[model samples]
Target: MTVGSRRGQATESLRQLTEAVRTESSDGARLVANIADNPICRVTVDTGIPCVVLAWGSYATSAQLRFVHECALDLLRRHALHKILGDDSALAVIPVDDQGWLREDWFPRALEAGLKAAASKCPNGFFGKQSVANVMSGAPVGITVRSFEQLDEAKAWLQTVKI
Candidate 1:
């Protein structure tokens, strides 16, 4: 099959997976968006707070990274979120190429789109820590970035952010 056909098939598969995992409000959080397949990330709006929760899967490719960014951007546009709680504890490795794109391109766009504060739960291993470090180092001004080992702490910190 051609590359375009392969891409189309992949997209369809992701759509199906997203649909399978999609859920509405549960325990006060509302599902806003999700991207499945390679990266498998979901965005949910906290009904009790002005924050968005981003949960990432274990493995991710460059395409998945782009899709995650797109989904996050859409969520930002739809909700007036003051903080983002990024649960990257499952993320293992991020391709070096994708790292640069995230720092240089996606993050700037997110900041411009009104992302104010972000708290992330990072994986414990070297690769995951390094990936988070790279993105944190390159993050633009005006947004606060913090790393946490526990999801509860991350959420608590996000609550303290003024926006």
Candidate 2:
């Protein structure tokens, strides 16, 4: 390879590494986006599900998750979204710091933002389960977050929750 091409590749590699480190930090979820239209999350308000579907093993986890929560928050503010269905089945292990941000920074605001009940199709594999459990553990008394193996079961359970 030519020297110029090698230098370019090295620069790209450094950029990727920097971004990865920056996003994986514990406080990364605090971006609080002005708008939420990212690929990592879909807000299904019209279908009457009141859900946010998250992509599994997203590389840009920090920005993606922040956007997802931001979108959910926006949906809650505009529509009074109370119930949430989680289909975050994944093969990747979430970073502890990111999980911490979810628990500390996001969950409380989400509760105040109108999240009353959540039924999750638990993320696949051990690390995913553990990460999920840790994040859900921070929920206050007013809200509920339940995990289920099957998506149908989770949805059915969510339907039972009052308002």
Candidate 3:
């Protein structure tokens, strides 16, 4: 897809919510940690030069979701540093589901839990709902979503995203 081209509605919407700030590059390597505001609290991990939607989605509860969303800024800071330190590693992406965000008054707790799971499994790139569920279910690493209609875009983005 061309830059600025609108393809998938969800992907496009997520992109619109993200704002890139403070980009850094050294020796052909790039690091960007940007603040993203979406329907849910989110941290996008689009480093490694491929640009992936590392983390997206908001929590269900407004208050807790807001708190988690706010915390995403902090998370971004840490994520940036992590990427800077771990050069040549793939990014991780975690897209929380809307149901989890809405049905539970546990967004903050869930976010913390989810973030921990994602970070641990970040060695593996990309995660879908099932993968995330499994991580929450006690797996060491989050599951990776293996199928997508737009496989090329999905994979390309997945490579740059970290949970």
The candidate that wins on TM-score is 1
Question: Alpha carbon lDDT of residue 16, candidate 2?
Answer: 60
Please write out the lDDT profile of model 3 over residues 82-152, one tens digit for every residue.
22111111223333443354224233333433432222222233344344444334422332233233434
Report the lDDT of model 2 for residue 24: 63
Candidate 3 lDDT (Cα, whole model)?
Answer: 0.33
By descending TM-score, how would the candidates be arranged? 1, 2, 3
User: Per-residue lDDT of 1-163 in model 1, one digit per residue for the tens?
Assistant: 9868955875685565344334322311122232322336666677565777778765655555565665676577678565678888887878888889888987886887798888999776789889888888888898899999898898888888875
Model 1 backbone overlap count: 0
Q: Evaluate model 1: give its lDDT.
A: 0.70
Report, for all candidates in order, the number of backbone clashes.
0, 0, 12
User: Candidate 2 lDDT, tens digit per residue, 1-163?
Assistant: 9868955874575456445544665333332222233233344553456554444434336555555555566577677678778776752456788788777877876887778888878777888788788878888767899999987898888878887
Question: What shift in Å separates residue 42 of candidate 2 from its native position after superposition?
Answer: 3.2
Give the TM-score of each candidate.
Answer: 0.74, 0.69, 0.22
Winning model by lDDT: 1
- Candidates ranked, most accurate by lDDT first: 1, 2, 3
- How high is the CA lDDT of each candidate model? 0.70, 0.65, 0.33
Backbone clashes in model 1, listed as residue pairs: none
